[model samples]
Target: MSTVGFVMLCHTALDRAAQVARHWAEQDCPVVIHLDRRVDKASSEKLRSDLKDCGNIRFSKRHRCEWGTWSLVAASQTASEVMLAEFPDVRHIYLASGSCLPLRPVDELREYLKARPRTDFIESVTTQDVDWTVGGLNAERFQLRFPFSWKRNRLLFDRYVELQRRVGFTRKIPENLVPHLGSQWWCLTRQTLSAILQDPARKIHDAYFKRVWIPDESYYQTIARLYSTRIESRSLTLSKFDFQGKPHVFYDDHLHLLRRSDCFVARKAWPQADRLYETFLGPNHRESQMAEPAPGKIDRVFAKALERRTRGRAGLYMHSRFPRLDLENGKTCARYSVFQGFNDLFEDFEPWLSRRLGTRVHGSLFDPVRARFAGDADIYAGCLPATAALRDDNPEMFLTSLIWNTRGERQVFQFSPRDNQRICWFLSTDSNAQISVITGAWAVPLYLSNRDFSDIRKEAALMQKREVEFVNRLRNIGTRADVRVWSLAEFIEEPMENLQSILDAMDGPSAPRLTEAPRMANLDGFGQFLQNLKNQGMKPFVMGDFPATNVEMHQPTGGPRPYLVKK
Candidate 1:
């Protein structure tokens, strides 16, 4: 029988790595393990001990792998060479990560490869591929030399890269080499590996690829395409990417998809998601189990109770500039509509809000391009300047309307159209510095060449200036509009408590009876609340809390205090 060789690249989580090694070893396959040199000695020893029983296992010399560098490719090459030398008669070599889980049985895979005889399963695409347009990073990865360590001094490194771009300095691609991008994981025949290792241009390819950024993804795919016409442009490993180009981490929620995918392997799994590992590979495996089970009638009762307790009478509108705050269950208000600019809100979204408000809208003559406020609604719930504009455009709307500020800018002014009417709702932050970091993360990417600290601070300063100008205008128009500010962070931390505060300010109806538990608990407060409930013999129906809107502030703060508000 011609056996298959397995090469697994692992950095951390030795216990999980051991499990993966053992699984493949049990199938009578020869396995080569390459643990990253960065892993501590104790962990490495534990991994060795865990895999000591496997007779077919071999360990490769460790290499310290760095992200977006040639080290990863070096480690992979090291493991492949070891596997080829040890198992000379192996039919095919499968390359994967320690985090990867086998989606199909090993017997099926072995039989399938035996039938194909000479095919390579490698995902390859040219630089002209539409998918490479993500984050506009395809050009930069090939155009310049990223010599500096981005993890250590990201700001300095990005600035240097930008400076190079401005100076019009670019590196040349080697002759007779076309850059092809693809996933690093692949399965190749022994003949293909021998061809790659024995190629006359092997030295030249190595020398050139060492200087390339993220070469692991391109080096093998590019070479495989050049050498083999019998290539399948699909990887056996499955993965996902987010809008920001980060991998969407696999969790229990993705178990169903993994089971259904025809791919042999799946990657980018987290160490903390032990449930996924157990569900797929455990002794009593339950891969079909849903991550979140359907809620029972009791769950619905609690959900309705929480909804009644937290629902606001005033219409909620979120500005495009701010990140939409999600509930703990990853849900946002279903009724809200997003607008690009003030004009977009007035022209496109105003009619939608007017229908929801069911009131006569005034100021039809004002164009959004010329004027700040084109019209007003019965209630405005959004960021500072936009909410302020709603109050200014039609003061009559402010008489009985509510203005809920989501950005938490501090203000000392009171707005009361009548003795008992209060219209202004303030959402203050405990730390303006934190809010700046959050806003900077969202805004700086648009202006800067990359995500560097210097450019982020610069963009944040500009945002702070705009925030101050808007709040100043709001203060000037105060006392006429019943203004009340609530700390946004506080409300996010304690949803039930904060909902009551909002209703109290609006003079809305009393909250419904707290008869049933909530379907979702506040995430930050869940641990403490659950502990308290457990001691009192109670159970929580809710899964998660409202997602916190507060941006975690970092140390070494030296930016302009745009979040500063006058008391």
Candidate 2:
């Protein structure tokens, strides 16, 4: 049984904690919550009362907290210390804030943890002395008196931080000890947490950390560097930050942006951010509070699995029956396949696809294509959780979902294609490490820039127009060979854009900075041939035994599907 400890360190987040407590409790997972020192007992007690039914919940007493100060260290240490004592069985500790919400299901999160016993989720950020481990606190002030500490002095703290910024004295990682900085929010393994909590070398290292201006962040980085193996050095936290180096206040404008990142949680949203929180979570607007995913949610889950795999952002739960094309196809000739980049086309795609042999299929063997909105790094980032819902309960379906990330990797949401049975495709943004996808036919999104039309509402009009173009393209392409064009969107919508509601079938659910496209091609859609093959029960047939032509997959009688080779 895996456990998650949500470490809340602010009074402003008490009510949020109650909601989270109720959430995980219903999931039947254990939760350990703590209040910061300044949080009054009245609020804490009230929170405890509201969440009293939440089993396996424990609240801490020796709270040590001070905003923008090293006291945060004391608070985290105190909470973690107590957490270790109370829950010796906890395999992992996810230090989260009350404002953060789980984007993926709870079971998914736990499953991810169960696989990686050696890997730690805590990003060991590297910094010399003054570093970025949530760097608002200074180590020298750890035991300093409130009235005497310089960081405690509002005027001096600001001046000192600003001065440090002007001097441009960025942190350094000596060859012997490299430093990194990131969010304090972490998903840590027990071993890593234990080492930090009970370091025998703390006495020796403490003196050095004490000399640094802000050791709260550096202390962990230094210790982890000296200790843990290959810290990804990222807190996996993506809360919007302000110019002054503080968490930006999240508002309705930020709601959709947060979803696209495919991240498990986001942070620093204001208390009033409730409106956005309630309205836009990748799925339904209304919170279910249900123990199980509602009906037809399984398809959505499969769509996510497919999208993650395509993007290569698939985390621990990546399992696919798709045969390997790289080794046999001589993909080793290239370090990174050119196909690994982004491609986008707007018109003339429908007819092209109807001729392709890739999109055809009927019955159980015929898989419907569901599109996922991806691309445009300017839109948002995407990352998968450690674990996922069991495949048995969340079976994969052809028509899954399309996720959109506008605001250049900030907000994201899952969308259903109008034609789930027709076809689907993925595309990429021009160089600059962004991704974008066209679902069916969308009448050129206004601006097509990263700025406007950031909301999902903009999708309504394009959806209607594309559906018509889809069916026309399919019928037209099957009979014509002269047509040579491919729009990623039109291909997916052809046959019948409004064939079926894709989102109605969804169940649930990032990638890096990729560069642009320098080449362009006028290609043909292969759907027409694929459809005929599907009508044949997806049997193996060689198109033409020519190079770079139709791929022939061998199938023996009463045997399994065989290897695919280009004829």
Candidate 3:
């Protein structure tokens, strides 16, 4: 007869429980099962018939069990008593759930327990030391009355707790009984187990604990400390909980993860996971060497899973986990450049930039008519539509999707006051955005257009107002994007030096110096255009001061200045 016995607490999935119970009996380990009274007689009878061939296994008296209720403690007590009485040779009783499956061979578990015959494996910690709890009372769980089931009577439970707090009501704890909390799954020696079951104070402990919140977690944990000679302060079974205090269920894909735990058993496994059931419960599943249970081996993996569940990947936004605008991990994924006035101030700036950096350059993504995607495609990566109605419906998501879809490639696009200004705040706030602005550059297109001077004045005034507000946002202390701003006159003065600096910041110092510059737009009458706007009662200060009759605007950068040579 095996010295180790298993007492399984089961409620649902009777077929799966029968399989695990038979596995323990086949190893000569006496097994005692406790079925919840809530289960119908037909299902209960079926479970017994399925396991009748295993003579070493027996069923205990049925009792009603519920989450966070005393009935669970009652069921565990009755089941543990039956195990001791039926198996005289059993030295240790391992409490497991129906959903728990053995991760290692039964023989290894038996041998490992046999070596530490008197040791009790249970997690017992004081309330002050407990940190794994998610939301709920800790020490208060023991000090207050909890006759209401949190799951079944949530309103009553909360009202009663609040009432008690308002009236300053607290129950007196029994003497010499310090409350401790731990996982319900534990392994204990027969001497300590029997002492707890047969103690004269058992009635008093039970009466007080009957009204305690989630007594199943604290009953045995607190009692075992009084009788055990050696306590390992941990469970032999592997279990993990999420930040919400819900157990993480194992599926077929987690077979390798369970194996790496090296624990004897794991709970809350999916009942339909046939591969896990077959691989772990099979006869060929034996360990080459018996090692102590070390669930910490996989703690890091669970920690990362929790992080992904809560925060998700940066720059990703979808229907499932669309974080609030202010709470996103990253607004966009990769480093990308935005040109506010470059296109209007330079001829073919988009193609010029593409050639220089070997990157994709797009025109006004926020164009009122349609998105000007690279290569003039109707659709782009991530199947993003170029239609203005769809893109403008939710411009932020459109931008995030584009960046997330083309994560590895650097994106450069044109932005101007003429386009939609909805994404201005988004661009200023995103740290990944590298924005370069040439103020008053919008005037270049107005100057070159054949529109009437009165219309030009009105348009320039509106554009200047929008640009001023945008620049203020960029200059705000809270702004996160890398921002560079220059007036039209300021930029044209040293275009080559400024362009070289921008290239160095993007490509690093290893990039060769600029030997040629992009052709500047004809500004022959640009000074006169500013004068015209000012004369028409609109101030064009954003362009800075320019000589009215100056003819230097046509000169190309990196070329010789006009000189009067003596003939």
Candidate 4:
């Protein structure tokens, strides 16, 4: 007669449960099964017929088990009582769910329990030390009465909790019991198990815990402490939970991950994982040498999975997992440049910057007519189209996709008041954006245009107002971009120095300074144009004070100082 016994609480997948039970029985371990009463008669009959050949396996009294209620605890009690009465030689009772799969050989588990002898393996931690409770009630779960089922009657459950809070209603906990919480699955020594089942105050304990929320998690966990000679505060089975209080189910792909866990059993195995079932339940399952269980080996992998589920991959937005705007882990993946008013100030600025930096430089990406992709292509990286309609439909995603798809290469794009202003706040808030602004440079095109002064003044006023609003956002405390703003007058005074500053920011400190500069657009009449706007009853102070003179205002003072060659 084997000393180890299994008490399985099963509600679904009766075929799989029978297979696991037969494996344990063949290894000389006695098995007691508890099928939930809610299972159909036909399926329950099939389970018994499948396992009928095994002499050591027996079916215990059935009870309807509901999650987070007393019925689950009641089922466990009846099943455990039947196991003790039927198997006199069984010394330890291991509680497992129908979904659990034995990861290690049954013989190895018996030997492991033999070594421990007196130590009970059940996670028993005080309420104060428990941090994994998902619902707000931790210690309160013990203090408050929970008559309503959380899953079936969510409205009543919540309202009752709120009412209890309002009235300060708390149930009195039975004496000699400090509330403890842990996984419902446990492995307890026969002595400790019997003491809990046959204690003189069993009725009082059951009556008090019948109203406790999720007592299965706490009943055995807390009661075992009173009788066990030695207690190891960790479960023998490997069970992982998500950020929400749901078990992580293992599939066929997770075979290697489970093996690395080195646990004897794992809970919540997917019913369809054929590979896992075949490998672990086969006759030759004892491939690994017996070793102490170390479920922590796979903890990092689960933590990463949880992070990916909650925070998601950085800069990756898709139909399946599009996170809310404020909760985005990263707005965009790579560092990209945004030029406000720079293209209007220089000739062939896009191509010139491309050659200078050996990077892709695109014209007004948010242009009102269409996105001016590099080389004027209709389609660009990530299959992003130049259509204004598509881009405008979801501007943030368009920008995020462009950056995510072309992560290895640096991207530079232009923006202006004339283009769509929808992405202003997005650019301002994103730390990945490197923004260089020449305030009021929008006036350069208007200055050179032959349009009537009346129309020019109206458009200039509108553009100035837009630029001012955009600039204020960049200046906001919440703005995270690397922003550098220069008024048109300030920038033109030392164009080369301003250009060098922009280059250093984009390319790091070691990069060579700009030896060749893009040709500055003619701005001889630009200052007079601003004055004309003012005369037309439009204040165009955004461009700052420019001289009415015809001289080149943006030209560097003189050539580099001649250097003597050392012999």
lDDT of 4 by residue, 147-255 (tens): 9999999999999999999999988888889888898889999999999999999999999898888999899998998899999999989999999999999999999
The RMSD of every model to the true structure, in order and in angstroms, is 23.2, 22.8, 3.2, 3.1
lDDT of 2 by residue, 1-567 (tens): 555555555556677667766676666556666676566778867888987776677776655555544566666666777767877777777777777766556665666666665566665533344443344554323323233245457786656556656775444323344444446777676678779778876665555444444455555655666666546555544554433456655667655555555455567666676675565332453333422212133335434644544444311122443324321211111111011001222222222222221221111111123122232122112332112122112222111110121121221122223333232221111011111223322322221324333232344343544433433443352322111222443333231221111111111112211121122222232333333333544321211111223322223256442221221
Residue 39 shift from truth in candidate 4, angstroms: 0.9
TM-score of candidate 2 relative to the true fold: 0.43
Best by lDDT: 3
lDDT of 3 at 369: 92
Better of 1 and 3 by TM-score: 3
Tens digits of per-residue lDDT, candidate 3, 134-194, equal: 6669999999999999999999999999999999999999889989999999999999999
* lDDT for model 4: 0.90
lDDT of each: 0.55, 0.43, 0.90, 0.90
Model 1 bad stretches (over 4 Å): 132-135, 272-274, 282-567
Residue pairs of candidate 3 with colliding backbone atoms: none
The best candidate by TM-score is 4
Q: After superposition, how far is residue 291 of candidate 3 from its true place, in Å?
A: 1.7
**Clash count, one per candidate:** 18, 65, 0, 0
